[model samples]
Target: MEEVRVKLPFNLAAGETEYRSGVWQGLVLKWQKEHLLLELPAEADSISSAVYGGGMGRLKRAVNQFVSRDYECSNPVRDMEAKLVEWGYPLEGCAGLMTAVPLEHAAVAEEDTGSAGIFCCVTAAAGNAARAGSQRSVLAAYRPGTINIMLAIDGWLSPSAMVNAVMTATEAKAAALADLGISDAENGLPATGTTTDAVVLAVSGSRRYAAEHVYAGTATDLGGAIGRLVYSTVTASLRSVKAAEAERK
Candidate 1:
């Protein structure tokens, strides 16, 4: 049940448009047997320079401040799953641990108003299933007021299974800020990257049954798309497990 963290780098040396086109790489978490592991890719690379103005400006600063020289990051879904598979770990659902921190202003009065980081984290957990396979459960975690809306959904529903549902929920929240005519990438935070845009991070956990398995998930798409795939995979696996269990009964 131990957690192992590994820093991953891209094969920029292998490709021509490595840095310019962006490559996938990141930090990984694995268990004792090394069978299951989770990957956490920094959100710094998820910036869409075109869609969100000032995204690149924020991205550059974030990379320099939070990421290492070798860090080749790209969103955090597929990369996370890839890291697990590469390590030979089975897929699981979300872990149900989501939190958001608000942003703040450093120059304001000392006692008047501090900032909340304004962040959200989703956790997915996977474990052995009935047919000697693995199953996952996903949970969405967000900030107050808005977070409850996401949690109001069925408790047993995996965040992966309801990808659109989750994104719709998040976009709805972001829309409010957008309506305020605020740029998603540069609000007013003192943080390294674009202070305006909100940061949403999702994490998946893989647990190895024994101590001899290898770690494999990789962070590929940091966009909302991968979230759909993760959910689809888990939902399919769960169905297969249920069918097998029924046969055994």
Candidate 2:
């Protein structure tokens, strides 16, 4: 399946709602008394553009502007986490969530033929929408690469710890992107405002596969913890298989 890059809505200021749409479904990135919803068409196949039916060019421009200007520094995780801590999150004990998805899985999706590819199965809804509000403002402070980590945290962690989890993931993801020559982690990543905290990273041209680690808040939060455990276990299993394949080579 083709992996397409998408831009989120850009006008989500304080108290303003932003809406984004795709071909199959819609999403509302709800904020403080605001909505960032995505528009979707009935026929998924009709989507020629990226998320929001917008072209990739527009997406690219938005990315460059958001990351280049807003996220000016090449390294901003430290400052971002500092802000989070100031906001009352005990980030010292925060753990890293890490996992890798192999190209073999992509092949499996292709072979299935009846299913929507692996991208669709594990992908998040997205479109162009800017982050607003104090909570969102904290999120927008980081680069796209780091923001994606936060996005994963929002999915994996409970609402109570979502903010802190995102901070931790942001640190990890920034390190990964820097190692991969992605220039600036802030602008290099791809995200959509399809949901409250849904985002997908742009991993083309550098890595052979995409990795995501969902920090599901804490052990007490069963819902988030289960998400973390399932993803971690599956990824570890895949990594072992991948390592074995490498040894055969």
What TM-score quantifies how close candidate 2 is to the native fold? 0.21
lDDT of 2 by residue, 1-249 (tens): 232232222333443334332211232222211111112121111101111222111111111001222435444445434443454434432211111222122110111112111111121111222222213333333233212221211112223333333333333333322333333223434322211222221111111123222232333332233233223322332334446567989
Best candidate, lDDT:
2
In order, the Cα lDDT scores of the candidates are 0.23, 0.25
Q: Model 1 has how many clashing residue pairs?
A: 50
Q: How high a TM-score does candidate 1 get?
A: 0.22
TM-score of each: 0.22, 0.21
